[model samples]
Target: MSVHSLNRLIELREREVERLNVEVANKRAVGDRYRRSLERMTALCEGSGASAALPPALSLNCGNYKQAMLGMVDLHRQDLALHEADMAVSQRALDAAARKQEVFQQLLARRQAQLLREHESREQKRQDELATQVWWRGQR
Candidate 1:
C-alpha cells in the first residue's frame, strides 16, 4: 500500500487507542465511586450499633435499621464485584488496542523510511546521470 494509505490506517488505529483509553478511565472512575460508597455505608453501619443509653424502643429500631443497612451493603458489594469484573475485561481490551496501535505505528515508520530511501536513491541516480552528461560534453 502507498504511504498515504498507511498513514491513514495509523491515524485510525491511534483514534481507536485513544477511545479505549477513555473507556478505561471512565470505568476506573466508576470503581472509585463504588469503593467510596462502600466505605461510607460500612462506617454508617458500624457507628449505628445499639447502645445501652438509648430507650428500649429506640434501641430496637436502631438494630433494625442496622440490619437493613447491612443488607444494602451486601448488595453493594456484589454490585462492586460485578463492576470490577467488567473493568477487567475493559482493561484487557484497552491493552489489545494499544498493542495493535503500536504495531501500526511501527509499520508506518518502516514504510516512511523505505520511501525516503527510495526517493534519495532516485535523486542520487539523477544527479549522477547529469554529472556524466556534463563530463561527456567536456570531453567533446
Candidate 2:
C-alpha cells in the first residue's frame, strides 16, 4: 500500500483510540459517582441513632431507615462493579487501537526509507552515465 493510504489508516486508528479513551473516562466518572454515593449511604447507616432512651416509635423508624439505606448501598456496589467491568473492556480496546497505530507508523517509515534509497540509486546511476559519456567524448 502507498504511504498516503498508510497515513490515513493511522489517522483512523488514532481517532478510534481517542474515542475509546473518552469512553473509559466517562465510565470511570460514573464509577466515582457511585462510590461517593455508596460512601454517603454507608455513613448515614452508621450514623443512625436508635438509642434506648428514644421513644419506641422513633427507634423502630430509625431501624427501618438503616435497613433501607443498607439495601441502597448494596445496589450501588453492584452498579460500581458492572461499570468497572465495562471500563476494563474499553481499556483493552484502546490498547489494541494504539498498537495498530504504532504498527502502521513503523510500516510507513520503512516504506519511506525504501523509496528514498531507490531514488538515490537512480540519481547515482544517471550521474555515472553522464560521466562515462563525457569520458568517451574526451577519448575521441
Candidate 3:
C-alpha cells in the first residue's frame, strides 16, 4: 500500500487507542467508587458499637438489621462484579487498538527503508555511468 494510506491508517488507529483509554479510565473510576462504598458499609456495621446506630428516630429489630445489612452488602458486591467485567472488556479493547497502531507503524518504517534503498541504488548507477563515460573519453 502507499505511504499516504499507511499514515492514514496509523492516525485512525491512534484515535481508536485514545478513545479506548478514556473508556478504560471511566470503567476503573466506577469500580473504584463501588469499592469505596462497600468499604464504608462494612466499617459502619463492624465498628465500635455492637449494634450500629440507625439514622435519627429509626430503629430495626436485631434480626432485621442483620438481614438489611446483608442485602445491601450483596447488592454492592454484585455492582462491583459488573464493573470489573466492564473494565476487563475495556482493557482488551485498548490492547487491540495499541497493537493495530504498532503494526501500521512497522509497515510505515519498512516502506521508508525500501524508498531509501531505491534512491541509493539509482545514485550508485548514475555514478558508474559517469565513470564509464570518463574512461571512454580518455581512450579517445
1 versus 2: better TM-score goes to: 2
For each candidate in turn, the TM-score is 0.88, 0.93, 0.84
lDDT of 1 by residue, 57-110 (tens): 998888888888889999999999999999899899889888887888788889
**What digit string (tens of lDDT, one per residue) describes model 2 on residues 80-99?**
89889888988999899999
**Candidate models: Cα lDDT each:** 0.89, 0.90, 0.86
Best by TM-score: 2
Name the candidate that leads on lDDT: 2
Off by over 4 Å in 1: 51-56
Candidate 1 similarity to native, TM-score: 0.88
